[model samples]
Target: MNHGSQPEPPLDTPFGDWLRWALVRNGYDPEERGVQRRFADASGIPVATVSRLLRDKGQPDVGTCYALGVTLGIPVMPLLVRAGHLPPEALEKEPQPTERPRTPTTEEEALTALGVIDETDRAAVKSVINALTAKHRQEGTS
Candidate 1:
């Protein structure tokens, strides 16, 4: 519970170790002054909870892991697995394929994909595309 400027002890558990490494990798120094409070504020976690996690005193719940992952710009599955909430096998599960938006195949499609609804804007875009295509063709023939 010492919140002084002294460097905190190294985390001992696997999750805690990983969290510390993640923090450092994301440009946070756990041992720096007010780092716990900063991390708690950034992750929307309580200061006590963050401190306890840093000390390897308790496991983080799913919400906590999600918040930490968002704040750390890292994936949440690893956090959950490391916190012992999910089995290591969970990491091996194949991710479901997300449906990707279809690519625009024409100038009109590109303008629509960009949500350009104004007729004037569409005309301008077409003009630019035409100019680029003409330039490319001229260059190819050179």
Candidate 2:
């Protein structure tokens, strides 16, 4: 059976950049989370494969493309396009409106703000927060 058309990128375009954008937009920071390693873990693809892909070493097969899309919460078609799997006509149509990304929760904001501090201090703060949270849970309070 024929797989659907895959969008093709020009030889000059760095498809890995597309993947990076998708990952960042979805809150998977390579810098913070060991990008390739975490993505490999999440997508069940090999770390070497992800590394090669990031390095623009090869094109992913349909299944790999799908895995990356699912992991990053991005539309697979654009990824397919970047992978040169579809015809140019596929992207000629109008784009769909996507939901706005959810705002970070107060806790997320606080933790992110804390992330700017020294790593040891941040760890200590996180430990304190965890202990307080556990105590609150024990007391049956929100």
Candidate 3:
């Protein structure tokens, strides 16, 4: 029996669209990423069958992923990553932590001297500390 052209029912409807959107964003031109056609021709599975499979959802379980990979000339692991079932390895890079500004001894000294003049000096010291920290952050970012 011919499986109609309608998309397969999925556990999460948005997931399909989200996957499709990611595929497109990742430079898989719809024209070139003809996964169904590619799978069908390579696997000897009918295009209609592949099309029906694409329509179904629920994270493209491992077996389904393997079937498509076998047909599409893609590795199954990467395909799962594309669908967000697997985290993309490219995203695993540790972002270099920015170094913050060193607390300025000069500012600390100035604040200490000011504290001697004003009995209520805690606020001024805190303000200086905050300023140094902010400067350090800004310098590291640049």
Candidate 4:
């Protein structure tokens, strides 16, 4: 992995161990250079929480796992599934249809066609569209 990139953790690896592995993959040594503290700062996670997470001390909440996934540049679902926040089925790739697909037309439909997999990410896309639409309205551009 590159200096800023994280490796995908093995499926059998414990979540806490994977968290530490992510630090190493990103070129940060949690023990030597206060990587957890830096991660806390970068991720807005508390130091104590990061410490406990590293030590596998407690079950992390969904939001915490989501934040960690965002910070680590990894898909949040796998972590969420591992943490029991989401079901394994949620991560399964849907089968492609054998027939023709419906095409989207309107802006909203087109946005929906982007195929955002996560509800949070989908909401974020909608929020951005709403904000941009409002700005366009203010500027008399749309």
> What are the Cα lDDT values of the candidates?
0.79, 0.71, 0.54, 0.78
What TM-scores do the predictions have? 0.58, 0.52, 0.29, 0.58
Error of 2 at 137 (Å): 65
- The window of 10 residues in a row where model 2 has the poorest summed lDDT is 1-10
lDDT of candidate 1 over 53-130, digit per residue (tens) = 888888999999999989988788877877878877887883655656678998778889999989999999889878
Q: Residue-wise lDDT of candidate 4 within 97-131, one digit each (tens)?
A: 75557888775676678877577887788799899
Best by lDDT: 1
The parts of candidate 2 lying over 4 Å away from their true place are 1-12, 93-142
Give, for candidate 4, the lowest lDDT window spanning 10 residues: 1-10
Residues 15-133, candidate 3, lDDT per residue (tens digit)? 44533443344344334557546546656656675455445434555665676567445566666665557666634642435655345477456566555446457666677778888
At residue 53, candidate 3 shows an lDDT of 44
Global local distance difference test of model 4: 0.78
Q: Over the full model, what C-alpha lDDT does candidate 3 score relative to the true structure? A: 0.54
